[model samples]
Target: MFVENLGIVLALTGAVLSALLAGIGSAIGVSRAGKAAAGVCTDQPEQFAKVLILQLLPGTQGIYGLLVAFIALSRIGLLGGGEIAALTISEGILYLLACLPMAFVGYFSAVAQGNTSVASMAIVVKQPTQAGKAMIFPAMVETYAILALLISILVVNAI
Candidate 1:
């Protein structure tokens, strides 16, 4: 029946959302950071390492999202299990809800982290020695993404 299949659909949607939203956010964040990195590198090519590190800072959210999605997919038997569990509607909804935190938080945090990275890159351009301080700003944004990841993981495991 259609109702029976709805659970699978919901599970799939959660997996997709977890990957898609976070991926998009990381892409945007990386792009923004890359631009700033390029601008800095244009003037001082030798500082590429610092700029690259800053540019990559926002990408952690995407990884966390992927981790959550992978775990969810495996839980739902979409990954590699020989048999898939028949999840009830409530279970499906639970799965979807579990993913929501990571999806939303990852998306927002990555973008914010990216902007912070860009600003940090600007600082690196002006005062190269201050790169350490600059990195701290964006690293702070990563805390929320980690928290979301933890929540999603725990929720999915519980379900």
Candidate 2:
């Protein structure tokens, strides 16, 4: 059965990794940003909303990871109970390879965005009036996450 069902197993592995790796990254990223926000809010409680928004920026990758995993799972019949035979070993490897981009990129981008968010929070501390401008710095890091999400989605769907 292992040989016969290898494809479905691999496909499921991909789906799980997409969610797992990205979620881990987001957790770390959010934790970093949250710690920074908490430090800033100690003195400037009024800036809660601004810092909260900034802290959430890195979290999109986790959500995107879930989306891609769901799509891949659904495509591979894990969601609808379609059929294991529909996917060959080659297709399973393809699915696994396709998911790698989201898994790795999401992980790195989230950590980077989190660090960026922390730095951005410093702007909130110094120039409350420029809080809006401060967001731009972390927001820029989101582009890579978006690109990874789009590519993963496109490739998983195509496969």
Could you tell me every candidate's TM-score relative to the true structure?
0.98, 0.96
lDDT (C-alpha) at residue 48 in model 2: 98
TM-score of 2: 0.96
Give the number of the best model, judged by TM-score: 1
Off by over 4 Å in 2: 81-85
lDDT of 1 by residue, 65-122 (tens): 8999999999999888568889998889999999999999999999999999999987
Predicted model with the maximum lDDT = 1
**How far off is residue 102 in model 1, in Å?**
0.6
The per-residue C-alpha lDDT of model 2 at residue 107 equals 91
Error of 1 at 154 (Å): 0.3
Supply the global lDDT for candidate 1.
Answer: 0.92
